[model samples]
Target: MAGWEVRPSDPGRARRRRMLGLLLVLCLPLAFYAGGLWQQYKAPAAVVGALPVTVQDEQLLAEVEELRQRLLVLSSAEKVSQQANEQSRLTIKLLEEQIYKQQQDLASYKGVLAPASRREGLRIRTFELQATDRPDYFRYKILLSRVGKGDTPLEGQLQVAIVGKQGDQDVTHELSALTVDVPEAAPTQSLAFAFKHFQAIPEADRFAELKVPEGFIPREIRVRAEVQGEKPLVRTFKWNKEE
Candidate 1:
């Protein structure tokens, strides 16, 4: 039996034992590191509740707090940049709309001031009243031009008067009176112009907004202008019904 015990060792069994020993040696450090991590950061119960913390856990918690602060700073910067970009887009859109409106106004004035627009001396070229999207509101554009006069400017003050039915009776209201929807109104109205060939009443001088009375139908508009050396030029135009 002693001789049998000393028989040749199995090569595979020896190799397996050596490998197992080496594996344990290699796994000892990893196991210690995992235990340290669990004790410091992870709850012993493995459920989301209060943990029994140690001094080392405070350091891990501090590291987590630092990571949270860094994340907040990065996220705040991204949010501000996005908001700034949105504001820039809105500003650009508004400017584009303004430019488009100015261009249209310029083209309209150019047509009215052309050389052919002068059919007679000190005449009304166009009187257009446009209703806006708001109820009881209106906007008007009046073009006054003098023709056959060579290079001499026409200096005068123009006045606009509206004729419509306020109620059962016919009524007349000036530009300033129509600023309010009421019938009894005091006026502060003057549309003055000095141009070589033509004049378009600017926004400040024109009736840019008009508040009409409810159920009132406009019949005619009178544009009366008094030149520097001549008598008043009176022009009565029928309200454009189709518009």
Candidate 2:
């Protein structure tokens, strides 16, 4: 007869086997999902092509630098042009002033040569004072003219005095006292003159300079002309310097 074998069963071991089977069943979906994610991560990515550079773009790049250089050159040229224009304007202004001065001198000469309506005898035409480089030193000029067409030379003595204040007292300084150089033969008090039509003081060949005394404030000038056979003429002029 065939022998029948019977073994004892463990309840805890059977329970453990069933739990493992259930856990395996639960993990099946997670494993499948993880495998799909891995596949996507390993796949190659799509590429994008770069834009092509044209000839016109390259030309523009070269022109940008060239234009910058040209702009700098043009700026310098403009500055130079402006400076030249300013210089030209200044030169024109100076020339105009010279022309005006010349015209005035011409008019004065004409008046002296032909005075249709003027008093006869020696008359003061112009008196001018120009400051020198030295302080309180000046160059003075006096223009004397005789009216009418008389060819006879007029003889006279001119006296100049500076009227101003010295300290608090009013004072007068004669030309003789202020003259820098005094002639040995000429009178020390007055300047003698002999001219037919017109004459300038100290003559054109000589230099006449006056030194103003220290602490002397001048206001106006007093000129006196004592001509032979004529009444003494006295004239006053405000103290001013020639430009």
User: Against the unseen true structure, what C-alpha lDDT does each candidate score?
Assistant: 0.71, 0.76
Q: Which candidate number would show the highest lDDT if scored against the true structure?
A: 2
Ten-residue region with minimum lDDT total, candidate 2? 44-53
lDDT of candidate 2 over 43-134, digit per residue (tens): 53321112234556787889998999999999999999999998997686566545544544554466567756777677776666766657
Clashing pairs in 1: none
Candidate 1 lDDT score relative to the true structure? 0.71
RMSD of 2: 14.7
- Candidate No. with top TM-score: 2
Q: List, residue by residue over 186-222, the lDDT tens digit for candidate 1.
A: 4655767887665655442344567777788778888
State, as a TM-score between 0 and 1, how close model 1 is to the true structure: 0.47
TM-score of each: 0.47, 0.53
